[model samples]
Target: MKWRKEEQTPPPMEESAVPDTGWATTSMSTGAMANWTAVVRWSAWGLLLAGPLLGGWALASARTPVTVPTRAEAPRAQPASSDAVAPAGFAELYVAAYVKAGDSDADTEELSAYYPAARSMSWSGEGGAERAESASAVQVRQVSAGYWSVTVAARITSSSKNADSGRVRYFQVPVRAAGGRGASGWTAAALPAEVASPTSSKGVAPELSYGSAHAPLDSDPAVQTVRGFLAAYLTGGGELDRYLSPGTTLHAVRPAPYTAVSVTQIAEHGQGPAEGAEAQVPPDGVQRRLLVDVEGDGKHTGSRPMSYAIELRARDGRWEVAALEAAPALAAPGTKSNSEEGQGS
Candidate 1:
């Protein structure tokens, strides 16, 4: 296969009402009205003080409208756990693209501008000036209506800033898988606000190529088969593996060590990429997520590390990369804006 190589890289609320008493019933009258007067006077004071104070308290606790981000949220992608090795293909592609795009002098503002959800590429500086560092787990929390946990980590260096200023202020965020076993579908509600993009890319679909026979795995496959592929891709080396056919050895493993692949999410699945093609709908009426990851590696010997995807396809009873491309890695995730943005002692 022709490899396009490049290098470069809790809440609560309460309410109550005060009873009113007539002023006519006054205790000074030396009649039964005396107690009533006290009640009336006290009630008045209570109302006077309670109105604004109670109202303010209620307002404070009121639920505000969920402001949908002006720019869509970052697409949720689950970081494969250390033991959970993801399908090998796209990790390479994802990392490559991420780094190349991030490290270059190319106006990142444009990235923030062109795609609003892309604003996540900056680090506020809470990371502090690292005298030295290593790629540690960033954070994996729920962002949207999905079920997967996202992770943000970094492969740091011993310098003042990481990618910039040698402080190494960058985030490599990853989303966790949402769906349950025997169920290989997802929905918008299954994710956090961080990675879901409401907008769809128009015009051309990625002209991805699947190789021959054992190669170009058919996009049109049984749902069970697809699920198996995803499971394998996620686990790295496991049952029903993706990149492996028969006789494929573990040594074939290529570690994108410095590459930080964030949010490995599933895109979409259907009958199209294969012969008898059309949108492959889950009989149970579930949506299939398309998986993608972005990271970079400029150290690789090349002009610049170009990004490529290692997609999944089901062929001859197994899943494999349909197409192959080379790309750079992306900047790390959970990056802070300033020293105190998300800093913790």
Candidate 2:
């Protein structure tokens, strides 16, 4: 009974501002195109500026010199000398010929081979005769590269009535050498000059490590071993290896030059085994150095005396000869054996 008419209003119409919308889209596109153009221009300029610099750097690297390291080479060896033996021998022979010539003009022809300009020589006496027994070149020294001075020792015996027996004299000769050792050439530079003998120190006594007070008794195993070894070595009585240590090499004298040998004295470097301890076994790896004086009864000749510096080592409680020492050890200056002083006191 109360239905009134309901009315609905129409929806609003869409706006038609097409040009404004198109203008807004076109403006955004233009701005984006300008940004891309600026970026491309910057990249092109950057590449153009760097191109010449990179090319110049590459050219400079190609033109520059390069050094590679290498290893150094070793020096070559020099050839052997030729002047050693020939000049020394020639000088010795010349000295012998000079002594025989002895102030005579007729005998000068012998000297002509050596001196070439010799007419005569000088002598102290008028009517004495001198002869050379033996001559040997003892020393040779280089004055320069190829020049040498050879000293010859000559034994001269005079036939004069009151003159003494044969005497030793030294003469020096100058020589020049050329060519190789196989094919040699030599010339005498000057005549011989009589010089003084080489210096001597025979009066002085050498101090050795072995002392007189350290003599070991004959019963000691080391002393017995040395005695037995010497007997075999000199007279060929037994096998030398029986007393020799391991790795030791020795040979007995061939043909048995002697009939018997006796050990005269033995001087040990340190304290020896206790008295009557010879029967007991010594410690293994023990070592002792000894100076042994020996006399050999020769088969045909008289008794000959000799000395040996020896080393002995112990293994399995037995002593064996080790080595023949090259030289006896020396004692320091102002050092005296304490055992000697103890015995004296």
Candidate 3:
């Protein structure tokens, strides 16, 4: 066992051998990788160069403006005149134009401006006489959006071969807007008609009638109260306070200083509920309408009869005058005449 231990030895180490194709393979692989990298770089540079050029060409083409032909525009219409724009003002002007006084052809020509061709003959013979009409009150109501009904109370004066006279008259006229663009003027559809016939005689009584259900107005206590108030009002007495409702003024019934008025007869028109009746009462109160026939005597002229419509309302067991529409006097002087005051009831 001692001799065997002395003879043991390890094998000698050997170096690893390098292949002969190693350098060539390394060079080929490195060169191929370099070439691939160069091609990719060139491709990237080509894309970068082409992208901006394509985008610039597209943007330039898109931003280019195109020309187009256009037609000329038409002019806008001018607005209508101020006179034509206002309906009430036009109506007043129309009435004034037709009512002006003259005997010359110029007056007829002036009136013709307001009339249509068909109505031109209405004023044909108006040039031969001196006729004047003046409106003191004008009340207009619009019946529709395009039409209006006008009531004009006027004094008409004329000088003729027989006599020179003046009178009060009411006219009802219909007005409508003219058709067509930029034509805002309102035209009278036709000549006006008289609202009421003039009184024929002096101191003549009006025909009195009543509904079947209603009693005579003279017997009604409410009507008697009104009659007493009216008599006091016409006599220039200021004792109408008890007969009038609170805050009621009687400007329409003020007596003319130079004229004497006498109420001859009173007639009731419609039926009203009896006093203190609980059934079918109006909201304000029980209202009664009386048509009073009056005779007015001027200082120089004799007496003339006229009719008036008066509205009365019952309050606190008494009647008060609510409204009055009195006819004008027949002996009223012309507008040109030298008189202290015009005759109005």
Candidate 4:
């Protein structure tokens, strides 16, 4: 009574036909294959056309000039002390070399070294060949940055037998600092001229009386203040504004560079000549003159003795310097004490 045997089912076929419409029997005959072939042909033609363009571009790039950045050249350097102002003591040196009464050929030659060749020749030819007995008292003043005025006192004796004894004369000369081909540093800028020429007196000179001995005024408060001020001023030590008057020309009295000066002695002088006359008493509150001796040690100028005539007055309960001058003792006819000569010497 079992059911009848189940019927058997057959498997699907292994090979099947693909439908086509007006194409070859191969897979490459499809629309996709045609697009691929068209693209390949276009690529080959593009390669051929682009090759020359790329090569021309490379050649043009190589032929073009390249601009490499460069650095600018550095500027030249200058001297450290190139300021236009002349150095210290140059005016004095110029005066000493340029102004004199009479000079020999050798002396002129030596002096000529301080001037330009052309100027030296002119100076040598102009009365500088005569030799003189003595020349002294040279004074120099700076007129400007590179210019100076010099005054020299000298005595010249004539070569003739009948000629009178020489008289003291003052000659004024102008000088300039030169930086030329033949001359450098200080040089004589011009020839000298007679400013004051006074003859010697024929009569006998009058005798002078010696004054009473005076003692140092260091005990006085005013003198003490002045001593301290001078010490500071000459040594470049403490500030001097407190002791100096407003608008005071302290710079003029300031010592030379790299110089240290110490006050050695201070003596009070009466208000008149120290000899041949009674001492006149100065009025109360009037400034008094003091003779001060100082010793100095300098860089260029070695240690030496110096004397100064200092005047001071009392103001605001403090003493202040009013004026200063150099003092040297020289007793002779037609000769007077000159501060410039004292300092320059």
TM-score, per-candidate, Cα-based: 0.19, 0.57, 0.36, 0.33
lDDT of 2 by residue, 265-297 (tens): 777665555557766777877788888887889
Superposition error at 247 for model 3 (Å): 5.2
Worst 10 residues of 3 by lDDT: 336-345
Question: Model 3 — TM-score against the truth?
Answer: 0.36
**Ordering by lDDT:** 2, 3, 4, 1
Candidate 1 lowest-lDDT run of ten: 182-191
lDDT values for all models:
0.36, 0.76, 0.58, 0.56
Off by over 4 Å in 4: 1-218, 252-259, 271-284, 299-302, 326-345
- As a TM-score, model 4 comes out at 0.33
Please give the distance, in angstroms, between residue 138's alpha carbon in candidate 1 and its true position after superposition. Answer: 21
Displacement of the residue 157 alpha carbon in candidate 2, Å: 2.9
lDDT of prediction 1: 0.36
Task: Give the better candidate number (1 or 4) by TM-score.
Answer: 4
Per-residue CA lDDT of candidate 3, range 1-345, in tens? 456557667775444433576454433555687898899999999999999899878777986665565987787665454334545655555556566524456765655454453234534344425343666436777788777777766666655644434676666767777654434355677766658633344666432332222233554565566556655666454476767766777643544442566667655554335444423323457777666776666667677776667777867665677766454223223332112122231
* Tens digits of lDDT, candidate 4, 148-245: 77666656554544454476557676666664533345566665566864434476544211122244344455556665676667777666666665
lDDT of 3: 0.58
Model 1, which residues run further than 4 Å from truth? 1-226, 236-243, 246-308, 312-314, 317-345
lDDT of 1 by residue, 1-345 (tens): 899988655233333322335543322444556677789999999999899999788778879834457786776655344335432222222222233344233434433322234544653332322322333333444544343343323333433433443233333333334243212222112111223222343754332221111222335443334444333443233454344434433332243233222232222322224344423432322222222332332255322222234344444543444433243222234532222231343
